[model samples]
Target: MYPSSLFQALLLSATLVPNVFAQSSTTTDPTQRAELALSALQIWYNAGSGLWNTCGWWNSANVMTMVSNLAKHDSGNAQLVNLATRIFANTIVQAPAKNPQPGVESQSATKRSNGNETYDLFNSTGKESGYYKMIGEDAEPITIFPKDWDKAEYIDVKNLPIMQPKEQVTTVAASNPNDWLDGFYDDDLWWALGWIGAYDVTKDTQYLTLAEGIFKAVTKAWPTACGNGGIWWSWQKDYMNAIANELFLSTAAHLANRVQDSDKAFYVDWAKRELDWFTNSGMINERGTINDGLTNDCKNNNRTTWSYNQGVILGGLVELNKASPDATYLPLAARIAKAAISELSDSDGVMHDACGPLCGGDASQFKGIFARNLQILHDAAPDAAYVKSIQANAGSIWDNNRDEGNMLSINWAGPFIAPANASTHSSSMDALVAAISVN
Candidate 1:
């Protein structure tokens, strides 16, 4: 579970999703791009494991949508049918019979408080006994850390548990189903993406059924905090959880459109409200470098801009663009995309995993966000500037991050730790695919 070939291969979709030269009356050349994207997708499907490299689950869903919709266009990527089917089967098998436990809540759960909107599940050291290994062979509580992996002294596994007041736990506010809703959100995003892709591919309603089930779970678990209904920053409010709101908003919109059901208005409205809350309160400084979370707001905790947060929001805005075509969402997305291109890079051409007063994480964390930014830039503004930017960054990411060892190292591992960093790598992967298809 070191590095995944899946992302490296599937990234071809980034190149294909944006339509640089499509005219109002002309059909785009989806065949060559589809082939290129599928070629990369095929590599991932064959190589991914049930764990560590489970992006096979996500990427497969995307490819299925692609084939189902684009197949009629030049019979796109016929070989992907078998591969997507198998990956779907594997995803079903890999899904836990029950959701994994997030981890033991903080040792001393505080009583609720007024105007106290967040909490922490892990201590400041970022240490815990939760299982995070993709192997899924051992049954330990899932938390920031898994039990049976190599440990470094610098990597503190057993430390104090951090908790905000009990009120901060809003997903299953009355009852705790699991901690942080980590992989479950991934489930939500992918299910909706699969539904849309399926519709575009086959116009089959059954895929809608699958997608609806996912939406139901997501809505049931959606958080209501900060005077807005949104997902938390993380299990621990101190680290980063608010970004989940952005992921949820876009996912909810996709559901609303895909189902065409008036019943989901609450979910869609909730998404919009949270988006507003985030943009109004969470953004820090004039640069539009959105804070990681509330703590990041006061120049504490993670005082930097995270790629995943921006990526998920950008992805959400694109969906919002499709839903309403308003400047409110699109302009904000464009501004952040430009800021990311400028603020996150350095003289050595290395991307800081995060940017701000307090920023520290692995180099890999930045790759998905950077890729996603390039992707959205191309999708939203497909001129030479956007295309050149995407191509340039894509080359750098592919050259620097990819490893032949395993897709887990490059793709899976980063996404596995998405919550801690305030990025939605797993979800962003789906958006990256969506961006590619447009091209």
Candidate 2:
């Protein structure tokens, strides 16, 4: 059972009665909710011209997925389809390198011909500091020349035989952990769900096949790429992240239930164990402000709330609720949602400005995650008061975050297209679809 004090705090902060919506049985109005989310996506698409072109990451795919899903629900909106197609057309598929010829002459010629090319696949470009170039891939370099270098050292194939210089290492060392976490799985998880969500509305099994293949790859990559259980926080070789585990578990559960794969049960159980540990370990306070995802085995350490943790785990719990139907779990989740919107969310609908130091310096920075979670909650619980509150607040927040170009930052304004863009969960889009779903 959850602490009553925490429940009371949630209500008190919101200036409302405890579980006020619980007294009423109606789910949220799906159409109005979807329309609000759709408007956010439309804003993103109109502004994110550069993001749409440099694809393969969440930026383009996310918005595209939302736009496509919206088209299914509001068929009268012809522009949504056009925007989705445009985003898809801008994606990049990196070509795999072909094997070099076996002949010594060909090898020698190949070496000599390529001798002028100084960039190493594993080394840093100093342009996009943390990103490494693929040796044989067609990645365009912004700073290949010595003059173009940002006062950073460039290692040539001839001189740096043993190791790349410290300057190069520092550039990578200074890379942000959060950005690494964002790209760690590439598109495997999102693509799979993207296919599933698309299939649900379109009756097309191709999306299902895409999802299956992506899940298979994600499972295979678990141990190393994401550290044993796909639980690492920032793609760092050193630290293991609890948030990543939460997301992986949630994604794994979704896939497992959809396909009825027993192997996924292992992942699901691991997630439950971790989540149980988190709740008991005080990652969740009595007030229901969930600590940002944990570091493995570092109890009595610093843990602060991030909007992603509160919302994403709740989403996972919703899926778990569907599978198991525990009455207590949903109420617990509802209570947690209450804390999220009241305590963590700002009066204007952004999240995590109240976090302590362990939550990191940038904790107050990400408004998008909060918006996405609000979207998640609307889908899961659909409380009228919460819906009305979020819709009013979110519109202003969305408008505030919009840049002159109208496109928002992934870290800042991502929620408008988050369901489609951020994680490929089609969360925003799925929420829209769920709104339209009559069952």
Candidate 3:
């Protein structure tokens, strides 16, 4: 059960004055710090929308995963479990309508009218024409357009072509009533992993089944053109990125471990196939850290070594190791984790992204992903360095990176910046939760 009085006090104090709570300082205990961080995150929760404010669709998925991690770590806390259950239930019902708000859809339609092709792959004609473009927004919903349509004439914003609706699966009460799918494949995979994490904590078949549904949805995007392997990042098929493929591998391997049927082998094969392709795909650079994605020629783009690109693969490899028990999987994950720590952290061992100071919403969520997955890998194979790094980062987040409201900044190293949001709070929550687990 929740410590209602203490929680209410913290909320009240956060509401009253910013510096008061900061002056008093937060608890040094990792578990208590995690609990406080979770409470701070709730300030952004829009119960009506079933999503947090100031973050995108995919960021909410990471938020859910973060909460589920805390609930899993603190299983005895009935409040945490109940909170997870409520979020899982509400988000599936409310997010579809609220996420791609009417304005976002309008903006996407407007972009389409300007000869910016935005096609939904779920639509057969849209897939064939391949004239789609994603709007310049984070995880914006895809609007399908008819083939051979008049590019010159303004599109009827009111009558945009809707993508094919997802088939309703009866077993899961948390089924998305909207039957809506986003434009980005990585967005869907994040939700898949979120539901999987929720299932891990709650043992709820609905969540697991929902994850399976999401996984099945993404499986449709496995490209026949990209050398007959790897999932594309979006319906646009612009380029194959590390994050999407990492998500693909992780989701498959996770399902393989959770599902008990003939489908298990199918997932196992897919995970193995993805791993085989990913290992040879040239995304993992010479430093053993992953780059952003492949080039148009299917080579490593050698982009910024984003913390998330390094993080998700750790959890994926751990899951793959669980599914197949490969001798190389865990060690490979450890090496990458070590490399990421070496390359991404500062002299004081605090994690920092390449796009710091103002990493924006998406990048704000990146470091915590690295931290959370590092804990996953550590759970499989205990590493002293991983534990030390996790602890140090968690310490800095509370000591140097948080405000009076306990909201965290994008820079985990120090000097809490103003205007923190769900993305940063939940990202830091990932580190706090990881610290609790390893400590």
Enumerate clash totals for all models, in the order shown.
37, 7, 1
**Model 2's lDDT to the true fold?**
0.40
lDDT of 2 by residue, 243-345 (tens): 4555555565555556546555654664465456445544566777666534444442345455655665666676666655567666777787778778764
Which candidate number maximizes lDDT? 3
What value does the lDDT take at residue 357 in candidate 1?
A: 17
How good is model 3 by TM-score?
Answer: 0.80
Candidate 1: segments with Cα more than 4 A from true spot: 1-75, 97-99, 102-111, 115-129, 132-145, 148-225, 234-242, 296-302, 346-366, 397-439
Query: Which candidate model has the greater TM-score, 1 or 3?
Result: 3
**Tens digits of lDDT, candidate 3, 1-439:** 1122435434532432245455438457788788777767776665455667677767888999998888888888765666566666666665665433111111111112112333223222222333233422433223333353212222111112121122212223567412435556787789889889878876878788888887887776675234557887865556688889999999999999999877799888989889888988888899999988787667887778889989998999998888889899998898899999999989889998877857776788999999999999999999999999999999989889988767898888878988888898899889999999887
lDDT for position 274 in model 2: 45
Q: Rank the candidates by lDDT, best first.
A: 3, 1, 2
Query: Ten residues in a row with the worst lDDT in model 1?
Result: 154-163
lDDT score for candidate 1 against the true structure? 0.42
Give the best candidate by TM-score: 3
Q: C-alpha displacement of 140 in model 1, angstroms? A: 23
lDDT of each: 0.42, 0.40, 0.74
Compared with the true structure, model 1 gives a TM-score of 0.59
For each of the candidates, the C-alpha root-mean-square deviation to the true structure, in angstroms, is 12.8, 18.0, 9.9
TM-scores for candidates 1 onward, in order: 0.59, 0.53, 0.80
